[model samples]
Target: MAKYTLTVNGGNKEVEAMEDMPLLWVIRDLLGMKGTKFGCGQALCGACTVHLDGVAIRSCSLPVSSVGEGKITTIEGLSEGCDHPVQKAWVQHNVPQCGYCQSGQIMNAAALLTANPTPTDEEIEQGMAGNLCRCGTYNRIKEAIVTASKSL
Candidate 1:
């Protein structure tokens, strides 16, 4: 086991774990931050998505030791009172059904908007292609992204 100090949500978190340990487990189990979900361990699902230094990454496939000094941003860190533009747009558009994939969806959307403040429908689709919502809220998700962009 090795010790890793990660900058998460603007804070320093030190964890002792194996080099191959996925950051998803470290965040959910060790750090007790459950906002980041575990859907597929193989990184095929976007439920484990999180922001590593402002880039959307599959935390399930990211080894803890490989994070280095990257900043980790989970759904809980997205906003203080869930008032992020994307979050507000989500609520305004009623974007959640099961809500399991919402966090990752939101994180991915946030990262997309960060890189492209205003994205076309095709761009939005391309950007969010990785995140899957079993509830099939694709239309609402796309609408919410456009709404959030307008607000931004």
Candidate 2:
């Protein structure tokens, strides 16, 4: 096992695990941050998306040790009371269906807004391309993104 110091959800944590252990397992299984989900361990799905130093990343294929010294933010850290504009917009737009992909979708949307506070529809489509909502809420997702962008 290797010792890794990672900042997650604005907290510092020391974790002991195999070097190749996926960061998703480290955060969800070890650190108890379930907001980053497990889907398609091969990283094809964006269900395990998180922010590494403010950049959206697929956590399923990321090794715990590879995240040294970087700040990580899951959906849990997106707001203190889940009052982030995106969350609010998500609720206002009723974006989630089954809700399995909401966390990843939110993370990707958050990253997009962080990069471009006023993204066009095409940009939102490009940014959120990796996230798949099995419920087929793409239009609502884009609408929520636009709503959140304006609110932010």
Top TM-score model: 1
**Model 2: per-residue Cα lDDT at residue 61:** 96
Off by over 4 Å in 1: none
Per-model TM-score, in order, reads 0.99, 0.98
The candidate that achieves the highest lDDT relative to the unseen native structure:
1
Candidate 2 local distance difference test against the native: 0.93
Kindly list the per-residue Cα lDDT of model 1 for residues 6-88, writing each as its tens digit.
Answer: 99899999899999999999999999999999998888879999999999999999999899988999999989999999999
lDDT of 1: 0.96
